[model samples]
Target: MKRNVRLVVARLRQRLTAAGNPGLFQALRDGAAEGRSTGRHRRVD
Candidate 1:
């Protein structure tokens, strides 16, 4: 259905953002580069 396809597209967008954006998936690396700053971990659940 159309709604199902929309949901799939939204999920794909989230996956792409998480994978492509360093500020998102690379939080630990980013924090470390900022002189050991602490950041909240990304939530997957």
Candidate 2:
């Protein structure tokens, strides 16, 4: 079940990416990178 879910998600992501939704993909990738950077984002003023 878990593997199937992962496959489905991966396929969906690929289709969206192929569709040239760069802004949306970038938003998601940015959020993931931020989480990896510090578990969260730093404050900005």
Candidate 3:
């Protein structure tokens, strides 16, 4: 199950890179961090 999840995530990342949005994930992570600082309890993963 964990392997499958990793494969899916890898594929999605490849697709995102192909589409020229490689920094998309990083931006989202940064946004999540900012939200956390504001006391948001949302889980990105």
Candidate 4:
């Protein structure tokens, strides 16, 4: 399951790069960082 998540993130990174949307990609990174710092985990489902 963890591996699958990693794969999805990797694919997203690639697509974001290919699309030339650094700002959006950085936002995602920042959001993830914020979640980690706040010790909060959001469920997708």
Candidate 5:
């Protein structure tokens, strides 16, 4: 669980392309922001 969070944070950082930006942190704070679900078929939103 810890590793996954770290990886997600890393990817968020990599995708972040603004100077002195902190969008990634905000996104992380907003739980269930975006990600793939591991289960039966289902439509999000």
Candidate 6:
């Protein structure tokens, strides 16, 4: 199970690099910001 997860992560890294992102940190930050912006449109419990 751990090995499968590692392989998936490695594949993701390769794809991100191929797409020319600096790294996952920037991608995650941007995603978080996007989620937050969209969340403002919904009611929170």
Which of the numbered candidates is closest to the native, going by highest TM-score? 4
| TM-scores for every predicted model | 0.42, 0.47, 0.54, 0.69, 0.36, 0.48
- What local lDDT does model 2 show for residue 7? 84
lDDT of 6 at 2: 71
User: Residue 16, candidate 3: how far off, in angstroms?
Assistant: 0.2
lDDT of 2 by residue, 1-45 (tens): 768967875776798789988677667657757767888743222
Instruction: Give stretches of model 4 more than 4 Å off.
Output: 40-45
For model 1, the stretches where C-alpha displacement exceeds 4 angstroms are 21-45
Cα lDDT over the full model 1 = 0.55
Quote the lDDT for 9 in model 1.
53
Q: How many clashes does the backbone of model 3 have?
A: 0
**3 or 6, greater by TM-score:** 3
- Model 6: per-residue Cα lDDT over 1-45, one tens digit each: 778966875777777778887566456546656768886423323
Question: Candidate 4: what lDDT?
Answer: 0.78
Worst ten-residue run, lDDT, model 1? 36-45
What is the total number of backbone clashes in candidate 1?
0
Q: What is the C-alpha lDDT of each candidate?
A: 0.55, 0.69, 0.73, 0.78, 0.55, 0.64
- The per-residue C-alpha lDDT of model 6 at residue 13 equals 72
**Which tens-of-lDDT digit does each residue in 1-45 have in candidate 1?**
778966875675578687886455355334445543434433333
Question: What are the clashing pairs of model 1?
Answer: none
Task: Give one clash count per candidate, in the order shown.
Answer: 0, 0, 0, 0, 0, 0
- Return the clash pairs for model 3, or none: none
Tell how far residue 35 is off in model 1, in angstroms: 47
Ranking by lDDT: 4, 3, 2, 6, 5, 1
CA RMSD of each candidate after superposition: 11.5, 4.6, 5.4, 4.7, 5.9, 7.9
Point out the worst 10-residue segment of candidate 3 by lDDT: 25-34
TM-score of 6: 0.48
Superposed model 3: Cα runs more than 4 Å off? 28-45
Over the stretch 1-45, how does candidate 5's per-residue lDDT look in tens digits?
778977887777666735445764565444344434443233343
For the record, the alpha-carbon RMSD of candidate 1 to the native fold, in angstroms, is 11.5
